[model samples]
Target: MGVLSICFVSFVILFLISLILFTIGMNFLFNDYTIFIEWELVSLNSSSIVMTFLLDWMSLIFMSFVLLISSLVIYYSSEYMFGDIFINRFIMLVLLFVLSMMLLIISPNLISILLGWDGLGLVSYCLVIYFQNEKSYNAGMLTALSNRIGDVALLLSIAWMLNYGSWNYIFYLQTMSGDLEMSVIGGLVMLAAMTKSAQIPFSSWLPAAMAAPTPVSALVHSSTLVTAGVYLLIRFNILLVDTWAGQFLLVGSGLTMFMAGLGANFEFDLKKIIALSTLSQLGLMMSILSMGFYDLAFFHLLTHALFKALLFMCAGAIIHNMNNFQDIRYMGGLSIHMPFTSSCFNVANFALCGMPFLAGFYSSDLILEVVSQSYINMFSFFLYFFSTGLTVCYSLRLAYYSMTGELHSGALNVLNDEGWVMLRGMMGLLIMSIIGGSLLSWLIFPTPYMICLPSYLKLLTLVVCLLGGFMGYLISSVKLYFFNKSLIYYKLSWFLGSMWFMPYISTYGLISNSLVLGGTVYKSMDQGWSEFIGAQNLYMNLVNMSKYVSSVQNNNLKIYLMFFVFWIIILVSMMIFV
Candidate 1:
């Protein structure tokens, strides 16, 4: 078989394995059974070092979904990266990425989890820089360093867990809930999760990581890397449910959701807009998880993964046909040229907007209702609904720019949805995106949520969604008079468009001052004071002393005689004194 067939074969195998795993996971869920397998490597001082695996419905089902998404991604990449010389390398990296995620999902021990966690950070860095350009390098560095913060936090948590003499945190989560030390660990873990999930201050990297190929973006943003933090918190939900850390996450994630949604509205780059949407959805997941509804968070996570992956694939196809131009302004009337892709794109877009009966609707609608019924402050309530509206606004704005309106690109451009391989990959996710939400809602929840609210409150979600959609259409189709108004208010536009300067705050804003300080320190110490007092000054003194000694040693005849006479006189004087 050809090297390209490797990916196709892998996809088929993974697809079958995913189905089997899903079946097993469903059985486990129905039986409410957990299986733990452990292999002890060493025993010392009544403490044992062991590798532990936990098999329950949650891990198994999550793994199954992960594999399913990964297989489709690999299949898509075969066509997307078809002409590249390093296709095999790309496939291997993707498989490694999947393996790391699998390891993360199954391992119950902190030590083992770290192995997977670090694997994710490292492999993602490699994948981000796969293009080998300055832009890719900078983005890769940002992505790696941002994730490193989370890695350190995870390590700290593991160290703190040593107090309990076991790295299997599942055993201690219940007993350690009220403990001060455990709280500290939980805080560290939360910090780690925030970084991994790109919450608030750490969010810039998520959009920046669009440097990777589209297939990798689909996998990383949708299921593997970004979701790692949410999954970690899901496992540690017992520790976070009623704590200060949980409250902190709630505030941070809510703000993150708002920031990303608003930012997407102002973004022009197609991939980054989707990346921002992923960030927004991640914030939604984290926020609900913080509110102690981890099951809802997990549900949203799965549903989001399905549609978001399909969304990116459609984006990839569009970008491919557009000669790699990612600017949405350069795209219009694509729905006329590429009917199938546009259809899939609209489905994914509406699904993201939580259109009734679609995948996102099942989870996002439920989340809104739950938040509405909860006893949160008015500000939190506003943030929750306002952010939901923003989600719809951006989705519609994206569709308007790309799928509707007059053709914006050059007249000679050609567009078609002809890549059967690419379409086949999208087709799998497309089916899942349509039905995955209701299927998961039915399977995951044994009992339905009882959402009791007044008519106004119950209708609020639909109202906000409608308003958001209307605003999106209006904003995209602004009149020339309003365009002049936008120009007049350019500063406001710039601020909102720039993610409120978060990219600066995370990157240049944080590093520029430190770099200047480093330069000053280098001049004063390494070049100035150190040169005067250290090896340079010592070398000069040694050179002068050596010259004087050499002059004395280079005796002429007259000088030698004078020296001999002086020595004779000194000897006689000493003899007389004796």
Candidate 2:
């Protein structure tokens, strides 16, 4: 019948498909089977799970997350975009993206994986521009082009891997050390991963992607696209160990975590702050993966999915209620008007901060403990510790400013809540964020070496949370003049407040260096290409010479007849050739 009904049906179908996958996953956990579709070769081998190695613990965790987050997004969209013109189109793309990501998680070969990865990237590009605004369109273009760079690297690495090792995922793991080409291919593939995971130079597009709707932002940042890079690393972790690339990822991830956490300290825009925080959190996860702790990385990915999705959805509700203004300074005393949303946001924030007994606390603590145990090297130990503190600071800062500051006098008009659909989505996630850590420990990471943390670390974690929250409160309340002033003041506030500029700085530096190098080469060459194009002086001389020909350019009957005859001759020649 109508677009909304069709969209509703599609979402229902997607959920049913996800349920089937979940059931199959459970079966794989106990039984072995061969799956055949057309000429495709699919087999489940011996492991903790009889599922294909592609559907191991790592993929299952992320797949479950994708299904849950995607379903929530669809449910929320039905209400948020009830009367929108492109509701069906948006739902279709969303379903397609989810399907592609699911396929990516279970792809047993590099070729199949790349296909799914590229498909998801393409759908994300479309989603970013769904609003059809100039800003949304530009952000979509940037995300598409930047992600394509990663896709190219992935394709090249896949070709290299197939040529060196066998064309199967399992074969690569077995042959990694036996063949040098495996190392080379793995390194090249990791470069692509670094880009996809929003590490360093490729990190800029993510913040710009915030131009999309809040739900889309939540989906992209929390559970779906952003983790794709880290998931890639976890998928191929064993193959990447003992390589220089692995070491590089470790160091790179640490630096990213530290710097991005610092960057979030200055951000005022709600989404951009979380975007930077996502980059940092991913960096932390990548570091663990680099250190050869895939289980910890996977657990981190799971906990991150819970808390970060809740945070983003809560942010979405806040944005929706506040008429789409994402400035934290403009939102204060929300706990008074919207207690449930505020409470959900606060719990998720504390979880993100890794305060004791919270979802983030146990996951982050376990990761640090694993790192300390694995890398006896002091450098790795302290890097993780510093990152933990940074996480605490930024997460606390995020919760503090929005919940406890002075409400802006000119803040947006507020409704009581976003809606039942939106609340349902957020509430589900909030429950998970609160209890995900214990669930993760029970389901995965059943390692005997895992120790319960001493009470001192718990106390220290709470102290840091309180310190971070108070610091944010003081900064926001005391700096109210600068926080809300003239347009110029707002610009300065944004400048001081935005951490998304680092990528642009890198992008600018890249362009500037290229231009300078090109200029130097041009100046040094004896046979100048510029001369062949005709210089400014030569063009001026040509203009002067054209003055002499002006006398022959008179508009007269003879000139018109001459031109008409010339045109006729050309047309006649063309007709003859035809």
Candidate 3:
């Protein structure tokens, strides 16, 4: 069969499976049923190794979402990556990526989790570098190395758990929460989650990872790889809340959210803007999970997954039509040319802004209200509300630049939404983006949360959103005077626009000096002094000595006579001395 047919079949099968799993998850949730299956792998000298899988409502539902998204992504890739020589390879890599995520979702054992975790890191690296360019190679390296930090953290947690005589972390989270040593394990796990989720210092890789294909972005950034950290933290929430680690995460995630939102406002690359938005939402999930609201985080994770996947799909369609021009400056009036894709894009964008009754509103609005009701410090409070406004600001700015203005692309651009395969893939998630929020809200929370606050506090989200939308429009529609003022403050603009130089800090700042030092060592030790005194010098000396010996043995007549006379003289002297 053709690659396209294979992808279509996979999509249909996965879609059916997702529906079944969703139904089963609902049943499990209603009954509070958790199924744990264990198989003995080895037993020796009072230690036993086993593989375990947990099928709870959470895992089931999350798996359903993952599969659902993967199916659509595969279907989408059939068209997006069409006619590529390695289309088969791309499909296989995608399947492997999904498999790794499923393994992660189902396993409760730390060791087993590592299997899937490393798989994700490895497969994502391959996918990121699939285009075989220097940019993709660099991006893939950054992504792999950053995730390696988390892998090491997970390994440490596993070793620490070995003190408890098993790697199954689910059974021991409560026990580990109170013990000091176990708290260290918790800290290690939190560190791992931070790297995986791209929080604070480890966040540079998320935007860089856009070097991958758009289908991979839709899968990895939206529902699978990035969310793995949030999901891990959600699983470990029992040990995370009310601890120093949780507090640290809360602050870090808040700053990450703010930083990403600010960065998105400055980004011109269409994919990177969406990537930054994903980073912002990830921060939201991490922050809420740290605040002991795992369910809310999970809820947002699911809802975010729906719209984000759709958002990326829509982005893929636009980029595909634009001849791969991902810069927003090269795009405008696409709404008129590509109506279906544009409509889907706007829906996802509005959902991202948490427009009322959209998918994002149910979770994002609830998260904001919950934060307001909580007793967080003023700094955190500001971060929450300000970042919310920033989210809206970037979303509207994106829409304004890409969909509403006059046509800015070149004359040769054939901007149309004629790819039915891509559109069908988006159509599935578009429907979900419209209703997935309310649907998930109903399923996840059998009883509604009672949010009690004063009128002004209740209206805070709306007010911030309105102000943010206005600012977005203003920023995008700035006149020459304001633009000149921005040029004057170029340093500040560059700093904020560059994600506070995080990419620099992560790549050059972290490694450039070391690389320079390495070069110095290579020159002085490997090439200069060491070469002069070591192998090169020894070889030269040996060569000179060999030459002298060969000359003596050349059997030249004068040399032979002189050698014989010298030997005779030496013999006579030895005889006289005797």
By lDDT: ranked, best first: 3, 1, 2
lDDT of 2 at 421: 72
Query: Model 3 over residues 1-578: C-alpha lDDT tens digits?
Result: 99889999999999999999999999999999999999989999988788899999999999999999999999999999997989999999999999999999999999889999999999999999999999999899889988999999999888788888778888888898888667898799899999999999999999999999999999998889999999999999988888999999999999999999999998999999999999999999999899999999999999999999999999999998888899998889989999999999999999999999999999999999999999899999999999999999999999999998778888988888889999999999999999999989998887999999999999999999999999998888866346476679899989999999989998897756656788999999999999899999999999999999999989899999999999999999999999
Q: Global lDDT of each model? A: 0.92, 0.74, 0.93
lDDT of 2 at 115: 74
RMSD of 1: 4.2
Instruction: Sum up the clashes in candidate 3.
Output: 0
Q: In each prediction, how many residue pairs overlap at the backbone (N, C-alpha, C within less than 3 A)? A: 0, 2, 0
TM-score of 1: 0.90
**Pairs of residues at least 3 apart in sequence or in different chains that clash in candidate 3:** none
lDDT of 1 by residue, 1-578 (tens): 66569989999998999999999999999999999999888999988778899999999999999999999999999899999989999999999999999999999998899999999999999999999999999899889878888999999988899899888998988888979667998898899999999998898899999999999999998899999999999999987887899999999999999989988988999999999999999999999999999999999999999999999999999999999999999999999999999999999999999999899999999999999899898877888899999999999989988988877988877899899999999999999989999999999997998889999999999999999998888878765337576678889978888877888887787655666788999999999999999989999999999997887689778778888999999999999999
RMSD, every candidate, angstroms? 4.2, 9.5, 4.2
Kindly state the number of residue pairs that clash in model 1.
0
Which ranges of candidate 2 are over 4 A from the true structure?
2-7, 16-20, 23-38, 41-53, 376-379, 409-412, 452-474, 477-501, 509-578
Tally clashes: model 2: 2
lDDT per residue (tens digit) for residues 1-578 in model 2: 78657756755765676566656654554454434222334546642222233555456556867887777778777777777888878888888888788777777768778878998799999999988899898788778777888898888887777665444565557667556756876786788788778887677788888887777877788777888888877767876677788888888888778767767877778998888889889998988888787877887888888888788888888887887788887877788778888998889888888867778877787776555446346776666676666666666666667777566636447657648777887777887787878866765644545455567653554555566566555544546436445354666646544544565574456544655788888885533666655685588788887974674576678877887999999999999999
Clashing pairs in 2: 266-497, 267-497
lDDT of 1: 0.92
